[model samples]
Target: MNEMEIVADRGAWRAGFEERVLAGYRAAGCSEPLARALLERAAKGIDDWTVATDGTEWTAVGVTQENGAAVGRIHDLTAPQGRAWAERWCAGQGAQRVEVRLTGGAGAFADYPVRGQNRMRAAAERPELPPGLTVRRLTEEEYPGWYAGEEAAYIADIVRAGALTPEQAKEKSDHDFALHLPQGYLTPGHAFYAMEADGQVIGTGWVNHGFLPGVTFGFSLEVYEEHRGKGYGRAAMAVGEWATRRGGDEVMMFNVFGGNEVAMGLYDSTGFAVLDEFRFMEL
Candidate 1:
């Protein structure tokens, strides 16, 4: 596994990197689409590459790669050769901080690591997810509401953690908000379930379909703080799992901040296991 010798064009580089990462992920018996999604996100603004000598795989983002110094998340990095190649490449680019992020089945190097890992210290405990809360697929018409809920949940958590002032929160929350659901981003059959009590939405969960051939990605569960203790998270997750499996997805996956104990506990109780450990090293 020597460094890639022939650099590829931007699109070609992304595809090549994704293919190699997916191969590694599938070899590990992980989902392919999930791995692809992570790679797509990493390709957002990346440029530069170190082609592998064998011409089969390449180190897509090297130290000499300059796509801006902002935080970057790599979807997967199963190839030790590629990872080592990237390490050397980034070192040459004067990368002050580099994080090798592995998500789904792909991997990438980040110029800046996620700062402060203390936000989710009070991990939500796994409550007994209740029953009788009707869960169903989300209609296109309901996407707006779902998006709002997702934003609100994220904003609320950030505020609760004292990570941002109200003004800062609003500004940060509004940036590229529409990107949450770009056209053709998620399939209609993708599941988005809401827990209703008295005909009102109390909790919500959803799964995003993967870009790879057969993987299904699950995430975006938001239970109002008021509804936190009554087992809603578990219930929502159970519904989500059912929906994911119903969609022909064999494995379901989601990411929780390391400090989020409550979500971790809930997922653990529902038979979810930690597949990998990723750290956010800041510059």
Candidate 2:
């Protein structure tokens, strides 16, 4: 437990971390087909805070904070070895407790903070677009409203999932939207839009064609509070599928945090299959 190294580069020590990671996700509930490229992306661009054991190979991937506490993920590692690596990493971090996420076959590292679950979903077939509803590219003028609603929804979501307090959620959501959302829908390879019926903006949504080549991901679909229960959200998802298909894709994927049965029900109603459930633990 004293000298294990945890480095990045997707944990090259493992032959098939992606498959093993997907297996873990599957064991947790994800039904959507995950690609190695996606997991590979997760391993890139974090060398400074990363760990490297013996420099002979990488056993895990994580970052060390200013406090010397290591926090990140380990993939395709067995329990006994993973446990040892974790304890050693914590010691190296000069931390009494190191928080890490385990993928592949390793289970919980005994008493840790259980981050809530996220349910992954996917639908390859487009749903029927509700009659009289339409979607259009988001205009510059509506960006303000869209950002506000998205941040509010984001805060509510994480708070509900117990990942953040209301205050922290607000701050993080604010920061995230600024970093992730565009000023308008002019970005190539991504599409964002507003759903209108008779020229009224009932909701907003977006589809990321960049998620995977020819494959689209429904990033967000939110119907206004007042518009709830009128089937507007469902229509938005259908439009999301249509947009993905327009990009030459037959499927779309998304996730709903655990406890959002309303969203789970809606995805089911729209013909999306529950693919997996993903959770995190903080040690």
Candidate 3:
């Protein structure tokens, strides 16, 4: 097959790009509003979009910089030689540390070892909570302190991932944080829980509905530093899943950042399977 030509054309690329993103979000069980919000944020860099095409077929991709390194998003890429074209195209943009990301794992990009995010799912199982452990609503008095720490840690992680500058990460994190907790701890569709073991608070987690028709979104799970490695994380997850099932959701799903082996191991051991992934490769 002849090599495809890569050219800039945001107008032609925008529709397909939106379609691909929406489809991926749908598969990951995101609510329509949240998916649209995410799509809007994603379109911010469309000025850098390029189309790789022959006369009969095409794919759209956008490249942008993250912490001085090049990052590319390829949308519904199906052309045989599209990967080669994307590599050269990114390099031409003066990228030494180049990476190409896609919404889902396509065989065409199998060489992409890094996963940016994983949408994983498991059947809701009503496991017995570890002895002497209980999950309870996060009281209003505790919400503020909990969220402050959570947001700080999240911003730090984003910075460490080299996916955004500290300022950008904080802004993005706050925007998303507000979207989920518009009413703070009293948010209508969300449930924030504090995990207690032997009458002592040991961890926290949250879950929400409406992200998908009947799937519950497990939002956050954290075990305090002093509580790490004591199996509280797994126990917290089990309670979360049980709560999800009790709320009428048959499946519980959540997203995990790639390379977070500790979290991944916890989820995998607790019966979760990767339903979809945002795959990438650094060139």
Candidate 4:
């Protein structure tokens, strides 16, 4: 078997890779806006990419090849050609792990030599409220602090689980959570919210306008670890959904890792149905 050649053409591949991955996401039933925003993150250099012989785009941290296959590290891949290309990459590169994000029908193809398969769960409908909690929009002044708290909680969870070292977690957490800012909040079609108790924030969530049209996406929900299983996550989700519905969109969508059973249950109990599943593979 010939070693498949893998090349990184960041300049030429960047835009097309973003578009194709996002397009593949939409084809797999993801909302247009959510797909676009996810792609936008890739475009902003937050992700990387490589092109294959069939014109399929593969987004990842890097790429290589071995044993007639082309291998790459990726966040997601939805196109059939893209998936096949990845398989070839894996075979050729002797990749031990290939993190892939797959959606819809592509999930069934996991038999192609990956270590394990995980589902990416999503909620595309409005969320329901539990009791004794209220949901409200979060203002800009409040988001930064809220985001920081959320980041800390996330880091704490990962550290405890040994999924991330403290230094690695710190580096990953240093983001301007406000980058999406008012767009995820103040826009007439978007809403960001935080759950509060006696003037102190407990959890946070938000819905952004459709990345395209006629569809909306949700993000940024986080609850302090101490507050886990207490219904704060659900309340925050409900608040985001209510805002999306109020903005005139009928559907509200959000994604979760399949292995995150706690979160999957939270969304499931709040009226969110599983519309699609994606897998993350790392090479």
Q: Name the best candidate (by TM-score).
A: 3
Q: Candidate 3: lDDT over CA atoms?
A: 0.71
Write the candidate numbers in order of decreasing TM-score. Answer: 3, 2, 1, 4
- Residue-level lDDT tens digits of model 3 in 10-50: 45556766887888767766567656765776666666567
Clashes of 1: 18
Candidate 4 local accuracy as lDDT? 0.54
What digit string (tens of lDDT, one per residue) describes model 1 on residues 1-283? Answer: 3445544444655666667656644554554564455456545545533444335544445342223343323333435566555555555656644554453422343433322221111112332335557765556788787787777766654454433455655666666344444542264545676677657677777666542344445657777678788777776766555655566655556656544667767776766654444554433
The candidate 2 region of ten consecutive residues with least summed lDDT is 112-121
**lDDT preference between candidates 1 and 3, better one:** 3
The deviation in Å at residue 210 for candidate 1 is 4.9
For each candidate in turn, the TM-score is 0.57, 0.68, 0.74, 0.55
Choose the strongest candidate by lDDT. 3
lDDT tens digits, residue span 29-106, model 2:
443444444455544554444444554434554544422233445433443455566555656655534444444322
lDDT of all the models against the reference? 0.53, 0.60, 0.71, 0.54
- Clash pairs, candidate 2, are 5-53, 6-51, 7-51, 29-275, 29-276, 29-277, 30-275, 30-276, 31-275, 31-276
lDDT, candidate 2, at 99: 45
> How do these models rank on lDDT, best leading?
3, 2, 4, 1
